[model samples]
Each structure stands twice: as structure tokens, then as C-alpha cells.
Target chain A: MSVAMPPGSAFLPLSVSLRGARLVYDDLLLFDGLDLELVGGSLTCLLGPSGIGKSSLLRLLAGLAPRGMSGHLHDGSGQSLRHQVAYMAQQDLLLPWLSVLDNVLLGSRLRGEPPDRSRALDLLARVGLTEVAHSRPAALSGGMRQRAALARTLMEQRPLVLMDEPFSGLDALTRLRLQDLAAELLAGCTVLLVTHDPLEALRLGEHILVMNGRPATLSALPELPGAPPRDPGDPALQAAYRAILRQLDAGSR
Target chain B: MKARLWRALLTLAGLLLVWQGVVMLGDLPPYIMPDPLAVGVRLWRDAGLLLGHAAVTALEIVLGMLLGTVLGVLSALALGYSRRARRWLLPVLIASQAVPVFALAPLLVLWLGYGMGSKIAMAMLVIYFPVTANFYDGLRHTPGGWLDLARVMAPEGRRWAVLWHIAIPAALPAFGSGLRVAAAVAPIGAVLGEWVGASAGLGYLMLQANSRMQIDLLFAALLVLAVLAVGLYFLVDAGLRRLLPWHPANPATLENG
Candidate 1:
């Protein structure tokens, strides 16, 4: 059964804008005067080369930017939005001992709110993991583990979700399936997905941003026709992929 | 598992046989190296008295281990969370270990008196270092990615919640390893305390038998002590394995973990 979020229970969509974010690690200038914004309730894809600071930018937006960064992340509401974020890192950081269902409920448990098991189980079903709800993370395959992590991210009910190469480790088939599921499940939430695959970005992003340079800059790509889980085999997506690849190659040089 | 147990039993029997042969061959007096049969007879005859002393030693070990584990966890928390504690208390803790810890037995007995309190304190002293060192290493060395995720989840920056959820759970296997080391060495502290001043426990019995020239009975007390140490170790190992079932059950896992 599809679990509709109870009225007034789901988070109100948040708009995030970062201005003059200055993050330097050790001696390397990661971001100097970087500015970006995520329109409320939209999935924004970030694409770049291996080390072009896309993930770092996401961290900056989440207010988890590295220490000694001078910047303001204004949640257009003029308030701290850190508590409203859910981050899915490159590695599925599922607690090893917690069962799949409990892992999904971790955010609520941490907040001292009683877990809504029905909602968690419904999310697990959406991820096609109903069978392993009672299993520990180590018992699941790599793809299943990531699925479990995705379920956990969804359970947080947060409006702002930051994902860093979340599906890059999966096989192509599982990756495609997860991309479709994520696009559908996170419909009205603000999402920033960091990925290396241009096609995956074209398939899932409403508005894609390519970040590159010594001090980092974010430039937007044109919006595609429809919200994604867009047809990966479509000609338009292929053209966008080719154009984005060229943009990334040019950025690296 | 059954095969390993059988092999272990075989090895023990072979060692006993060799000991009997060596005693017969060397024509050694019973006072120097009593035959295994004589020791076994003494064990059977004095089982009641030996058990009473064994009970005291076991109690002291259990009490000290519980106290050590709690204190060690607290100290490790301080070391992990605070730079000042890391700098000042860490060196003091290490320096305490530098002087032979067993040498503190006499002073502990004098201070705490010749009772279970001194023995328990001695065991705590011996048990604290490894637990603190291993647990602190685990807490400080959590993966960067996990820490970042923890930060993102708790935007209020609830440091203790992050530590309880992410840091402590991640550090559990290391804590388990520390406890195992503590269990193996637990008997040492209690026996040392008894040697210093106690009138009860296996150590006192061993000393009494030694002075009376009851070699077989001394061997019996030594065997009882060995069994207690081995039993306690296995108990801790079994409990830890249950607690951390997700831990890879292999020799390589332990080496890395």
C-alpha cells in the first residue's frame, strides 16, 4: 500500500541559497566566494569531474562544510535549515547492527520521536526490500544496502536531501532502477544529487549544474522537458548527455 | 568447532603424559615436580576447600572487571572528546602503566587493607589501561564519511547523540577486544592482591601449600586458578560474540578489528 505522508506531518519544502561560501582545506582553495541556490521542492543534479568540489559544495549547503569556511547558507526562510537535511553519502552509512527497518527509523529515533514503523515498512516496500526488513546491513548485497540507505534518507522526512555519488557503486541495471525509484519517491523534496554519470544526471535532474575550477563555480544547464525518471533511451537525453560531457571536458581543461 | 575442541583435549592429554614420563625418567622428587596423578588426587580430595578459595578469587575478578570497564569507558570518553584531557590525562595514564603495575600490589593492600577491596582495586588497575587505549583509538578513528553523515543528520550539533549513536556503536568491537584482554589478565590482579596481604583466595591457598611443602595441593590450586582464567575468558568471548554478531567471525576480522 502506498503510504501517504500525513497532512501537516511532512516537511514544508525549503529553498536554500549560499552566498560567498569560502572553504579552503589545508592550503587548497576548494571554494572561494562560491554562490548557488536550490529552488524549493526541486531535484537539482550536480555533475563534475572526479575532484571538482561538487560534493564539497553540497556539504557547504548543508552547513557541514569543512572548518574555517566563511559563508552564509540562508534558508530563504531566514533560518537555520541544517536540521531539515538528510545526507546520503557515497558509502551506505547504515549502522551495521541495526536491522533494515530500524536503520530507516534512525532519524526519528535520534530525534526522540517514537518511530512510525508503518511508514518505515512502506518505504522499505517502495525500495523492493520488504523481505530483508529484519536483516542487518551486512546481510544485504551492495545494491540492497544502498537501497536500505535510500529508505533511511526518505524516512527522515526532511525537505533538503544531499546525496554524494549515492548510486555510483551499483551495477548499471540496479542504478537505473534506483534512479527511477528515487525520482518518484522524492517528488516534492529539494534534492542535490552529486554524480559522475552525465546520463544519470540527464535521466534524473530537473535542472543540472556543472561545478568546476580552482576556486569552484556553479553554472546551470537548460531544463529538460519533463521531471525525471525521464526516458534514459530518449534522443533528447542522449543529446543533453553529449553536450554535458563536452561541458565537463571543457571545464577540466 | 568440535574438531578444534577434540584437538585441544588431545594436546592436554599428551602434555600430561609427557609430564608423567618426565617425572618418572628424571627421578625427580615429588616436592620438586609432583606427578600429574598426585596433583589430580589432591584436586579431588581438597575440592571443597579449593572451591571456597576459587570463589573468592572469582568474585574479586568479576567486581574489578566491572569497575574497570566503567572507568575505562569514562576515561576514554574524556580522552576522545577533550583536547586538554587527551594531552594531560593520557600521559598520566601511560606513565601509570610504565612502572610495573604488579609492583603496586603492596601499596594497594596497605591502603585498601587485606580484604576483597584491595584485590578488586588491584584488578581494576590491571584492567583499565587496555580498555581505555583500545576504546579511545576506536572513538578517535571513526571514518570521515560516517562523521559527515552524523553531522548532516543532527544539525543541532548534538555531539553526545552523535557519539552515542555513531561513535560508541562503531567502537564496540574494539571495546570487546579490550574486555577480552581484561578478562585474561583479571586473575593476575586478584592473585597479586592476595599475595600482598589477603587471608582468602587461591593465591593465599597456593602460598600456604607452598610453605607447608604440600606440592600436590599447590599444583591443585594452580590448576584451579588456570581453569578460572580460561572459563572467564570464554564467558567474555561468548558474550561479546553475541553482542556483536555482525562482526565478521574470522581470524582476519579480529586482526583488523
Candidate 2:
């Protein structure tokens, strides 16, 4: 069976391989000799207990690690992701002065490219924020703000997306809906989402990368080949969640 | 807004009544402190002369504010951009404030002469520190999360692009606070400079009235100066509110589904 993708959204799937990332902060080695490889065009949900350096890996992949980080991270094309990535930070980080529409178009504006207003508007509509497109970020609800942030991430039109707990603060229902939306919009693009919720990981991730230990280590759990995001109530998905938790439990020791 | 305005008017009226009572009960002569009515009458009768002097004082204060704001912004940008420069220059800028700026008034009048230049210089000096310090603090405190987002958006070695888009806008509210403080204190500089030496402005007029024993006009000039200071502050505050429309305190809008 073939996967159905969005109309006019054909993008080359990218695979990323990170080797020997040595990330240290103030004499504390957060990550050392950390090697990770991401499946091409797949959603990789990285789950870790607090402070396991999951975000450091994403920073390295996105070429945003601190200046002195010693590592080599290459994508499928063997090229730098320095200009090929989009990131959604934990905070919405929307420029407060700009309207919601302008915040989504910020990446293009910063690059001096004429804003693709039609595309931004389309993304805004898809995210269900059409009416408040002219509203300031301070005027948006928490869920709506994160949706706008999600739209901005998609607006970059980058092959790879790095998201750090993009929907952690949302209500449960809102988080579930956004998970579905993110999966739909980011179907063809490679994505690495950092999250703490196990059910969220089971719902969205095609491959579960469990992180543990200081100078963090990564271990991949077994996965079902069904397309995400699967039903959080699906028995198969729940079984997969149990397996992931077990793997995490074993890896901790 | 109406309630707030009424509250302020009530407060002013109550203060004036107490002052009038003090003058009447204490049997203080008008020479020591003119009654509020006398001051008001003097204000109305000398409105034309007061307006002219007010115009001059207003011009000096406005020019000083503009210069100080521009210089302070430039200095903030410089300090924001260069850590090395900040390490050396920031202390020097702070140290300059320790030397009583009032002490510089006579020297400014002697050097720049008894004109608008000296008064403007004093006002500029008074306003420079708050603007620079607040702006620099704002720049330094840009959220780390925003910087990370900026880095990913335009990691093209485009420092100016990052600063213009993210750093400046984020820092503006703090900078606007500095401007408000500057506006509140701006009149002091011009008036002080005039008191040291000047041919025009309300401060100069008040000094002349004091020596000539025209205490009523002196109090009138003081009243006019107070009105101007309060008015300037409100104007600046209103302008800043307009500039920062997204005050981070608006009622949250629902996400249209």
C-alpha cells in the first residue's frame, strides 16, 4: 500500500546520521560519544527522562549546538543542515509585535525573500487560526499560540524539522488534535520531536529513541510499521507503548 | 479612564484646599508663599509671557530628549554587539554618573554659553544613563529560547538580520520604560541649566522674579513648569503604549476551528 501525501507537497526525504557528539556544559559532560541515526522521512520521537540531553542531539542535528561542540552530523545528501532545518522551541517565541500571519512568515522575511502570503495564509487556515491571523501573539490562547508556532515551523519548507516539546503545555485534547495536525502537515518531511509523554510518543513516533544516562546514550525500541499518528486507543499502539516503557526501564540500569 | 481622571482631579483639589487653609490660618504673608488664587491669577494674566518662555523650555527639553535617546540607543547597540567593548566601556559610563551632573551646569553654561545649547546639554546628560542602562539590560536579557529560534531561522552569519528582527523588538519594552523615566526627569536638566545662567526659559524667568520680589509670578512659573512636566510625561507614555501594542497582557482570543 502506498502512503497518501499532501497535494503539491513533494519533498525529498532526508536521513540524518550523528556521530561522536561531545556536548559539555560548564565541566559537566551532557553528551559524549553519542551517535544516532534517523530513518528517512519518518517521525522520530525522542523520549528521555529529565536531563538526558535529548535536546542537545536535536541542536547538533540542526547545527545549533554551542560553538565548541565537537561532532559531525550529516544528512542523506552528505550536506550541512545549517540552512536546511526549522526549529520550534519550547516557548512559542513568536515576535510579539508582529501579527500572527507575519510571525509565521518571519523566516522568509528574515532571509529577504518576499513573503509567500498565500502559502502563509493557507497554513494559517489549515491550523484553524484564520480569523485571528491579524491578532498579536499576546492575544492568542496557549493552544493557538503553539499552533501558530507549528505553522511557522512548517513555513520554513525545510526538509528537516526539530521540535522541542512544541505541545507539552497544551490541554490533553488540544495536544491530541495538534499531534494529528503535525503528522498530517509534516508527512513527507523528516522530523525529530522531543517529548516526555509516553502516550504522545506512541501516538506519533514511527521510531522510539529512548535516551538515558549522563553523556547520554540512545537506544531504539521495536516498532510497528503502521503509519502515524495511530489511535492512542489502538491496542497495537498501547502494546507498543508498553514495549517502549520496558525498553526504557531496562536501559536505565 | 474617566474614573482615573476624576480621582486625579480630586486629589489635586484636596491638595490646593489644604495649601489655601495653611496660608490663611498660619497668617503667612504672600511674599513667603502666594495663595493658590494669586498664583492662578498671575498664571492667567501672564499667559502670553509664560507661553513664550514655556515654548523655549519645551524646545530645549525636546531637543535634549531626542539627542539623549539617539545617543543612548547607539551606545546600547554598540554595547549589545561587542562584549569586549562592554567590558571596558560600561564601567566608565557608570562612573561618569557619580560626578554630580548638577555640578556640570556652570561649566556647560561657561563653555556652551548662556543659551539653549547649555540647557539642552544638561537635559541630555540627565537622561543619558537611564536610557542606556535600561536598553543595555533589555538587550542582554533577550530570552535564550528566542535566540535559538533566531539562529535556526537565519543562520547565515547575518548578525544584523538577527539583531534587527529579534533582539531589537524584544528589547523595546524595556527601552520604552527608560524613555518614560527620561521624560519625567527631562525638565530638571533644562531648568537647572537655566538657573545656572540663561536669558530665556521658565527657570530663568523664575530666578528673575525671585530677585525682583515678584513672588506671585515666580510661583506661576513653577506651576507652568509642573504642568509642562506632567503633560510631557503623559504624551510620552501614550506614545509608548501605541508603539508597543502587544503588551503581553491582552485577553486571550479563542482559536478558530
Q: Give the candidate number with the greatest DockQ.
A: 2
Clash list (residue pairs), candidate 1: none
Sliding window of 10 residues with minimal summed lDDT for model 1 chain B: B247-256
The TM-score values for the models, in the order shown, are 0.92, 0.94
Error of 2 at A121 (Å): 0.9
Candidate 2 regions exceeding 4 Å error are A1-10, B249-257
Question: Which digits, one per residue and each the tens of the lDDT, describe model 2 over residues A165-222?
Answer: 8888889898898889888888878889998778888889988888877667887877
| Tens-digit lDDT string for candidate 1 (B127-198) | 999999999998988878777776776666677777887788888888888999999998999998999888
**Model 2 chain B weakest lDDT span, ten residues long:** B248-257
Model 1 vs. true fold: TM: 0.92
Report fnat, model 1.
0.57
Q: Rate the local accuracy (lDDT) of all candidates.
A: 0.87, 0.87
lDDT of 2 by residue, B53-92 (tens): 9999999999999999999999999999988879988999
